[model samples]
Target: MKIHMLAAATLAMLAAAGVHAAPPEQAPHARVLQLDSNSDGVIDRTEAAASTRLAARFDALDANGDGRLQREELRGARKGHGPRGGHRGGHRHAGIDALARLDTDGDGRISRGELEAANAAREARAGADPKRAARTGHRARPDLLAQFDAIDRNRDSLLSRGELRSWSEAQRPQREAEMQRRFDERFSAADLNGDGRLSRVEVDEKMPRIASRFAWLDENGDGVLERNELRPQRGR
Candidate 1:
């Protein structure tokens, strides 16, 4: 009778604590599955190399220090904390995401006709539901449409995979320069002392994102970040 009573009490205690003997982890994400060549349910460094975005973040996302990215880590990333466990604003490959949206036929290329159709569809949807369009993060970019003729080098009215690649390559240096300029502007603003550098306190107060990466960015153990020491990561 005493043993039965103790078991019942323990079960109730466990229920209250929300402790389970074995909580099931969710299956790996579809993107992860596609690269999970070994079928072992997690992405290793070799498998991750194929994805530039994942490769750049692999070290940061490996929460267990086990060199393997599990579903929970990926989920955490989606929720915006997985990158070095920091509250930095969301990071996305906007160019890549935009291109994927443009390639609606899944044929790995975009034609003028397809582009028109996509624009028409987006306009119709936006007209029908202004709020939905305003809320969506993937709204069509007018800048790309404006440059369509210039990007179509062959006069074929189609954007081949290579053409897109070439355009992005051509734009890379300018984009990187712009990113650096913006970083400089922010750094200058945060440098309360006008010393051309940011101390920990300044970073914590003005730039929370840099605060999370202070130790890493503060090279030479100087306890502050110089302009050269704190550059934005490319393709972020």
Candidate 2:
């Protein structure tokens, strides 16, 4: 997919810059090669078939839907990365949206006073329904206030889009690493046989989400998952 190409391009650029002496064994190129079972240089339907995760997005990544995903196609798919913004299809930036909603003056910014007012309004709404309030805590996330305090770099008690964006960018890498760590831990725990792979039954019990797409992840139709199959498609 585009993610794969982006990873390859990144590694290639690093190599050109002398930042990467040689491709690492754990690199995306290695993983892609492993996934490309037929040695055809492309991830064909049969190959990608083992990954429900890939299959779900396969059509989008394929571009031509010819039952194959070329390197170029994967690169093209990386054009507009990240979640879709705005109030449309996918509300990936829900926190940002919530902040915008709190801009009571419609001035495209949220001040501490505005945030307080929003919080109070939410509390009052919850008070009107005690049961619902109890269930949801009738408040925003526990860290919301702390996040705002940190983002308000100047201590002006106000937040701009730029500050929020900066904070998000700063947290991205750490968040991604943590997610990968969690996935690795889960995968390791699920490998009951210590065979370095997970069978369908094991995944069904330990990682239902993956079990749902077992057929797609078993690239060679082996009915088992290799470490490469379970790993994130995005290169390391």
The whole-model lDDT of each prediction reads 0.60, 0.58
Q: For candidate 1, which ten residues in a row score worst on lDDT?
A: 88-97
**Per-residue C-alpha lDDT of model 1 across residues 19-110, encoded as one tens digit per residue:** 97886665545555566654555665544544555656554454323445655456544443333335322332223333555677888777
lDDT by residue for model 2 (1-236), tens: 99999999999998888894565557543444455543444565435544544434444454222345555444432342334334222222333443455677988877877766766776787678888566433443323455778878777778887776666546656555654564566568888888888998887776654466787767788889887776545311
Top TM-score hit: 1
**What TM-score, computed on C-alpha atoms, does each candidate reach?**
0.55, 0.47
| Cα displacement (Å) at residue 169, model 1 | 0.7
